[model samples]
Target: MNEGYRKDIIRYLSVLNNLGGCHIDTINGFLQKPSYIGASPPVSLFPSSDGKSIGDALYQLSIVLERMTDNEFDDTTFYHSKQLKSPLGPEEVRRLNEISLSAKVTQDYMNTIGRVFQSYQLFELLSSLEEQHITLISKALTSIFPMDQSITNDISTSKQKNYQGIIEKIKQLFSRTKIELFLHLREEIEESQKNPHKSSISQATILDTLDIKSSEYYLASALRQLLSTDENSLTTLVNELRKIQPLQITQLSLLPFKDFYQILDLQANFIQMANTYQFFKEDSNSQFNISTASEIKMPSTPEIKIVDQPPDKAIYKRNVKPAPSVSFQGDSKDLDGNYYVSVALLRCNDFSEEPTFLNGASKPTKITNGKIVTFKKLKVMVTSHQQGETLFCFRFDLRRYSSDPETNPNDFEIVSSVHSSPISILSHSTQLKSTAIADLPKVTEVFPLSGPSTGGTRICLLGSNFADTPAIRLKFGNVEIQPEFFSGGTLVCNAPEHPPGTVQIKVSNCQNQWSVTSATFTFEDTNTINPSSNISSDALSNILPESVFGLDFSKTFDTNFIIKGLETASSTLPSSNGAHRNYSKQY
Candidate 1:
């Protein structure tokens, strides 16, 4: 009896597997074949709200089957069902032979069958809960089309008698939108009963229209969707389990053969439907074989832009501070429907040396040609908006790259080539605090106060509190340019081209403060220098000593002597001596 019980459960599960289009393989049946068969149904038989109800049933069945095999379970270690030891009857043998390609599909289906059967408690609860529900739906149906017996049994037996027209009409009614279907059902129930007085059922309010009567019938239609044996029913029996307690699970030893017999009614119903409906009939030519490779199409490349970058100086405390994040926006026109996008970090200046997760971790930072931080790889889905824009924050484990700050000091900027800015990663909060309270730059003098209008004349500015950072900017009059480099107490930068007139020279450290020297720069057209002037090309060339030109002037130089030389040279000038002397004193 136990063997027969097990075999009978297998038979039903097999039928469901075939009907539901579940493809199962050995050991990992559901995992291997995750998709369902056939096109989607216009309406599902099972309520989608009762999510995973059927799958839960299948899983429960797998557990029961696993327990049933007991000592003979070779597949227990694999965590799935194995073939039963029960003697195969002719029907079981025939069904087994029909799908003899592998014994695993039977195992997978058996698991699902066990789950469904195990949920008998929940099913019983549903039945008890829907007692009035069934009556209301029946009443609604009988009012539309008078019947002598229960509408549920009639609908079931109608297929056996080839009464598809009634079923088709019922399907048409259910195919309407939920509101229309519920409202129509409510109307039919109200008209048939004609209760003039207000009862819960007779309430004509709009809110009452969506009450138990309509909702239950809608649920009934969803339940019916699970049994969709046609190709049009894309409804999957998996993932329809609803949570309910008192799931009174029966032991295999206590399980009666009558239970199997009761479930056989479903198989009979399916066979009857197969005989009546063209869709229920299996097509030998139809195959579930998916073509992995078809006509080759070139993949599309999306244009990704980083809309937001990490803060300039992110504090690097192990696990105490939030890791900086970058936001990227991709153009959908080039995405070509591909939703999987990847974003990673790379050293802004050096692509070869990627910021690895932990300083000593074995994982390589490089992926493909681009070196990306192995800390995390961001994969995001493209949205359906008109812009096709989606926001994703790049996050990764905040592991120390090195224990010593000297080895991995935060000088380099980390960025994503897709689009990003250089960000300074400070190892200590004190460094960030120091940066916030950095001293204001004070420029006392700018030597060689005059340069040719063509620009490119390297000038040295004497200043205190100057920092050698990328933020340093030098402005000759209104024209501004970044200095090549800065050292303690001095900054060297080429004067930008301006009109052949004097303009104030200002220096900025980008702290929103500018230090303007009293002296101004005079731009002179070198081509217009008078030949009679003693301010010779040699003197102008010798204006800055070789030590200063070579950037070797770490020692302080006399600003007055340099101004004296320029004044003496200007004294020999034809007409610019007065203007040169005036400019010289300001220094």
Candidate 2:
């Protein structure tokens, strides 16, 4: 027997041995094989053996098989097969044949049971039927069974009749039950349509008829329908159900506007209204106005003069007030009759001069009484002079009345209003000096130009520009290393440990001045070898030869040498050893 098949037989045997109240022949029939008197414990438990031992083993095997078949092992062919070639009586043989036939029938029936359940469509349909109808169908079908057999003769004929009867009964029952279910469903649907509030009842009925669990899709669909009808009560009920079954809520397809657009529109309108009200209130408080003005000019000759001149007291004033005279003047008189007059004049000097210049000037050449007189044409001539010579000047004088002439000047007190020039003091001063060269230091060299892998190695940087305390930065390749500045020239930096190779170090100071240096360093595996490990050439040479030239006895040894003394060694040993000893003694 194949080893694999033998193992399968062993598992079957174990199952049979553990089963209770089963028969030997029935178990053999389940195995689809005759019981052999000696099968070497099914070849899995033991090897093949002769008839005498086989007979005893078969008897024990039968006991195990008996428990497997539930004691239904009266099938004679399975038991009689243990004798192998022995001829059986006619009556015994006939009985064995009948048992074989019945065993085949039982196996066929068991096989059909599994197939029946595998028909998924049938199971689904049966599941959809009303519970009462299902129970009635089962009872009616079961009734024609084993019950009819007990009361009838000729077992084969009775079984056939019962089977046919139950099948017919199930068909008739399903037909009647379906008709009733359809009528009920129709009425429920009709009522639901009349009153959408009762739609839940109709929905439940349809789901029950289809035998579908109240899944998320189903519940959500029902909830959505209720919401569509504007049934607040139904909607609330559905929402409450969703809380209990969160999955149903997740499955629901929310109405697009209900949760999104409508809420957005409402917020937008509220914001717009608030803005509109703000604009309206602002406009009410502040009114707008528009006005226009016309431009007019008076000639320098004064179209009219309103001065009171006393007869016989002529007021003589200075002629030619100054070059570039200011023609326009404004004065405002307070209730006290004190005049506050301000004058603006354009300057005509190559450089500006102080107002004090006006205090002491040569008296006017032409004087009328105590007032100065100017030719009207002369005033016009000054206004049209060359660009640098003609200018407009402004002046302001405050005139106040005093009770005593000695206490305050009755003459106008001239006040000078000069515009100060806008210039920065820092720009005007030329004494400020530039940075001295003594402040800058020079750089020399960087040591251990490389960094540590774990980073943190203090390296000495040699150079100048090292101030009292200068910040240093180390650069390896394009990557820069941040260093701790310990002193002016000395920097404590952790060398960035990099891959084993030559690296460049750039040392810099607080002034951003840097110097580049190169260093070659090897990265050693600290775990496997000491960082300071060194090997001489001689030591290496000696170790290499010993390891490479070593011989292995295991590879050279033969089976004959392993099992016995060497035959070849015996023939050559004596003469060769004698000759070698004599030759050595002579030397």
Candidate 3:
């Protein structure tokens, strides 16, 4: 029963919530934290109240949807006002009015008979639907009423009679819809209890009830349509509806076009508005010419950020995805196998939040390519200690669409979710891709450019932006060499054996970026090595070869020296001409 009830509640909330706040946030908030509405024992119509009842969950859900603003809550509701207090602005008041209706609705559930129909999500859905219908009704009234009769007190007996009759008809239509919903809901409850797995309501069914296709809304529309066709009825209805003053004469007129355009800009559709504007060169219905310049020069194009990929090149469309870990076996001494990566999904308008790094994004935020909201991507590298193996799941948002997609944004979040628990950063990489390199790593020079062909010659390498890389590897020809020391400006590695010719010194970074040194290392051939003819026995006994001596890791070396290590024996030999010269050389 609990499973069935929860599923049904979610189904209801999916239709009701502005941004899935009710479905995702409300219940979780109630269960985990103290109730914002101050529920102590968790009020319920049932005897057993564990505080996790479906009805209680629904109630909390209603509060959440009723509270969401356009920015923090969803992409659609720009200004949220659930916490509105004294000295409110007009916009704040307007936003609060939607939530205030909760009191009016909750009052009906004070008794047992009323509590039977007291599903929080169901009421939330109905209230939101009612608000939507009211807006539609207001628009309909505004378009039909005559400007001249808008302020008139002249109400004919026949017009008054028609008005009263239509009002009653509207009441009956709405009243009947409630009865039908009540009966259908009861049947649904029974079915859901029988099979909890199939307890969900189809999306199409929920949309019909909340949308213009709902019985009462459809009936009201039919009534309006019938009257519009009948000229006399329309004339009387328009005159009567005008007295109610949904739209004024001035509001409909272009007499104050500039002011009206300013007001029009406040709406979401203002950017794409294809409204019929009646413009005249002079004020009194005079024909005007289309404003055109005699000669034209194309203005300089603005710096657009979008770059089209060439036909042969693959497109790089990044999305919020999981971060993966890989074995970072590199020549860089500092690099370890552990790495931290996350995809940031939230777009914050205020970046001054110091405790958390939220970027200040203002109006005209990233809303391109049919994107409904703005999101700031935050990528960071961390150690395993900073980010443990915390398990995380994902959350999704659903958008609403009208019959005419051209006129309305398809990504409208009439239905969306605001989870209390955050979706975790992508911890692992499931999708494999070629390493991305925005910049390449460089190896400027390798000190002591020549070494013995036997290898194990230490060389100091120099460059910049080395530590910035996640991993760095040094290569001597085909063999990947291990680095003894590495930093932003320098790296140390032992040269591997190669042919007597010069071998290129190459460096590769974590992102698969590669760079090579202009200065290459030459392997000194054994054929070039010969004992110095004037070398003494003392020098041979005391001195070691350059190959046998190790380098100072802290310092860099660049000087070149002779290849021969042994000294000549002291046995007597011939003099200067073709001499095996025996010289007294000190060690």
Candidate 4:
């Protein structure tokens, strides 16, 4: 019996793995190869939500199968299922296989050690809670579809409490959304029950519509999702379990298989629709072979990585490949295909990416060839978390925030820019605290300011407040080059790579306060070799000027210090040479 149980669970996993991309309501045995020898039903790929739900169930089953195998009770694993080689291309097949492997491992962590051993208790607890929930949902469902059965929230479970209100709220929410499919399924169930014995509807069809492979797996997976969302579901169930005496659990554990299943089926509402077939079918199926029906497309959103300061390179830093740039090109749309207000994380401090968590861990400051921060367009609709005065964006910085005239509007004042409309959050003045907004370091003199374009100049900054403050950073044309040393009224740092021209050298303090110098450093080109120095004396003399013309300074600052030909009254000016073209023009 135990071996059969394990086999049944593994085959269910195979079904999930193969048709995991299909919507939960569409999952049925015909979709899996072994259930019907003929052609299978065409299955559409599930949206991300349903895919996650189905994958999670398979993950849980894999865990149970592994545990049962460790005790040497069964040889069944989804790996041992009989299927031919996959028809999917190599990359898609590889990714699908990896998804299955990763999901099982994730479930291992999700099912905490204590909960894994008490699986049956947790399963029963969740199912009992959900049966009450189903009763409530059925009320909301029937109200929307009055032609269906006369289901009511009035049939409350003994342990259930304060659920009718929840039903009303669910009804209001579902009435506005695409939950029509659910109502239609309920209608289908009601019509099929008119002749219960001769009903053509298969058990798999009803189970799929209820969105479960088995009652235990469905409740378990729903509880997992609820732990992140409706956390009260888990809390309520666990509290009720705590009230149960150990003797009751021991009795439940020792009950005969038939008696236990009978009680289990009685507790669930969907079992009524699937009464013609075993709730947990124990049939061996073909091994794993990925099909083209499920195509797992990679998501557009990048999993950003924080790159540490890399080793210095010869190429321009910005031109070098940078860390990921996070984008939300489609964030404005809500789940219901309606537009809502959106917010972005804006940086205010001259330095970027402040650590949010307790530890100094944060995202990397490095980004592609442009600035790291920008504003994202907001969505219009507001949800609960985004009540009145929605947080359309988060403005952050390593230190203090000062509006940059370059990044701000032309007509806007930098000081008053934060208070403007469209971009809120700067309006609060009561909580503003006085902290270190360091003064911009003054540069009275820059010793050896000039350097080669190759950039190895040892430049000393002689300015006020140039002491070794922890956040002092020197930027030579945007690239922040680290300082070698800093002392009272002095800063020593290396020049960075630049073209053969003067660049604005700026000083930024720990507070992101900055002051700019007008082209303090001049970069000279040193790539040319002097051919005159290498030339021999004879060769040099041949190229030397025959005579020199001196510009007399006697009439200094006068534009008309001219030279004329002597006795030129009847003499002709020098004739044009063979190589020169001369022409007379009438003015």
lDDT of 2 by residue, 1-587 (tens): 11122212222333223223323222121121122333432111212323424233333332223222322242332333332324556776555434333232223222221122111112222222232332332333333343343433232434444444433332333333434443455455556678967744545655566343565123323222322322343333323332321111111111110223332333243234334322223352233111000001111211111111111111112222112111112221221333222322223222233333232232212112223222221111222123332232222222333333235435433221221111111211131234223334444554433333543433444554443221234565555655544346544343555565555555543324345333343333335545576666566444423211121112111111111233555312221111111111000
Stretches > 4 Å off in candidate 4: 1-297, 300-433, 436-451, 454-504, 507-522, 525-587
TM-score of 2: 0.16
> Which lDDT tens digits does candidate 4 get at residues 480-512?
764633355655555667788776676655323
- For 428-535, candidate 1 gives per-residue lDDT tens digits of 667667655344577777766676787666566776776554446677777777664435576665567677888887777643457644347789987897657665
Positional deviation of 452 in candidate 3, in angstroms?
0.8
lDDT of all predictions: 0.36, 0.30, 0.33, 0.33
Candidate 3 wrong stretches, greater than 4 Å: 1-325, 328-438, 468-470, 531-587
lDDT, candidate 3, 415-530, per-residue tens: 22221112223324432233223234666766666767866665667765454222356777766654543356666555666777777877765323457343577888867866
- Candidates by TM-score, descending order: 1, 3, 4, 2
Candidate 1 residues lying further than 4 Å off, grouped into runs, are 1-438, 516-519, 525-528, 531-587
Could you say which candidate leads in TM-score?
A: 1
Best by lDDT: 1
Better of 1 and 4 by lDDT: 1
TM-score of each: 0.23, 0.16, 0.22, 0.21
Backbone clash count, each prediction separately? 24, 45, 12, 14
